[model samples]
Target: MLRQSFTEQGKRVLKIEQQALIELEQFIDQHFDHACQLMFNCVGRIIVIGMGKSGHIGNKIAATLASTGSPAFFVHPGEASHGDLGMITRDDVVMCISNSGETNEVLSIIPVLKRIGAKMISLTGNPDSTMAKLADVHVCIKVSKEACPLGLAPTASTTATLVMGDAMAVALLEARGFTADDFALSHPGGSLGKRLLLCLRDVMHSDDATPIIDQTQSIKDALIEMSAKGLGMTAVVNQQRQLVGLFTDGDLRRILEQRVDIHSTPISQVMTRSCTTADADMLAAEALNIMEVKRINGLIIVDKHNTPIGALNMQDLLKAGVL
Candidate 1:
């Protein structure tokens, strides 16, 4: 009995919410475009206000907008009545949310918001409600029905409101020509930021830590340098310091199985003539992709003349948190 009840309830909720989303599309009218254009033309930041469930969605929308190149912040309607109103400026745009457009706390501040000459955008279910009527631009998130079986919870209404907020943010994001680099600036502490900002030179081995051997050196000499550097590989460079080939522990083992004379055979004979390399200024994440695709563990960083300037291995990428 319990399982059947759950199945029925889940289906009902999904059906209601799906209908709500479909109804929301028609509400994206000229007012929605006006709201985006107002935000795009704002000389200052965006102040988002809401109460209850709408408040939660409003906070997230503000965060998304701020991270995507729109300067935005959320102020609770309750707090705005106290002293948060000081945070709103005449040059800013105010985005207010209330499902019924009649929440007392939100409605109480509409007059002051207008008095300050701030542009107002409303997200509500009722176009004729007081808050909507007072707004400069009203975006209707009206739904056909509530997802709650008892019609008390805010399931469908919240979903429509949230999707509308997302639509607005994305429209503004594209209209402003916001790029990934702009997003990285806002999320500097995240993995995306690290991938774009960190360069090979910032994470590569330097000084004696880099394993380098002359092309004329014997396989035994290359092995000694690789061991001392502890990178499992050595860059084979010419007398001019230009990288000519690479020798790894794997290469050494293959040559040894063939009974090649390690002490007398030149490293250039067994070394890979063509290996993947990166520039010193290349992003570490790009270097990681090259290494992953080539199935190689190390990369030599070279200058314009192909001279070995730096070197990094998979372990270095891991240590730098690029893995």
Candidate 2:
């Protein structure tokens, strides 16, 4: 019975929060556009300030803005009062977040921020609150009711504020033409960064490490080259070093079944002539896609002139963190 009651209460909370978000959709009006424009046109960083629970949400909002192409950082309102206020500059914009817009710690620094000549934006539940009145632009994050049964906790309000922050970040992101490449630059240690930034040239084995063999070479010689390089495959090239075919472990199995003599049979007779290939400049993620769709484990990197320059396999991608 207790578990059932707890589950019902949790469901009630989620339902209330969901309705709050649905109502928030109506609030994305001219004011929201004005806030986005303010952030998009700013020449300097955005300084986000808040207190207590609002401070935690503000921190996340600042991080989202910074990672999405907008220069931003969070500043505790209490810390700002005690000398950290120097971080604010005339060219910067200040975003103040307070549920009631009457947080003493935040209101106390308003004068100093004004003196610094920073533009102010406010996110509050009350549109007529003091912070809203003082700000250059105001965004309302009001919720119809608190998700907490007691009606005191900040559950719904905090969720609304977070959604509003995301709305603003994405708006500015699109306005600035922020591409995946640009986002990857800011997140070099993340998976998306590796997918977008790493190319075949960055992970492929080139030069002597590339298993290249003359197309006229016997299957025995091709196997020797493949074993020496350990790429499970060898690129069959012409006398002029032009890629003609590929011989892999799978090819070896088929030839063995056909009873071909490895010492006398030329590799070109058994190698795959229409092997999948990638350019050196192609993204590693794109190469992975090709390998997956073609159901092949190995891929050869070719130059513009169709010369075999490098080679990589699924194992190579795993080592490079592209998998």
| lDDT over C-alpha atoms for residue 73 of model 2 | 100
Overlapping backbone residue pairs in candidate 1 total 0
Residue pairs clashing in model 2 are: none
Candidate 2, residues 141-257, lDDT tens digits: the string is: 999999988999899999999999999999999999999999999999988899889999999999999999999989999999999999999999998899999999999999899
lDDT: which candidate is best?
A: 2
Model 1 per-residue lDDT at 246: 94
C-alpha lDDT score of every prediction, in listed order: 0.91, 0.95
lDDT of 1 by residue, 160-247 (tens): 9999999999999999999977887887897888877789999998777889999999999998998898889989999998899999
Determine which window of 10 residues in candidate 2 has minimal summed lDDT: 33-42
TM-score for all models, in order of appearance: 0.94, 0.95
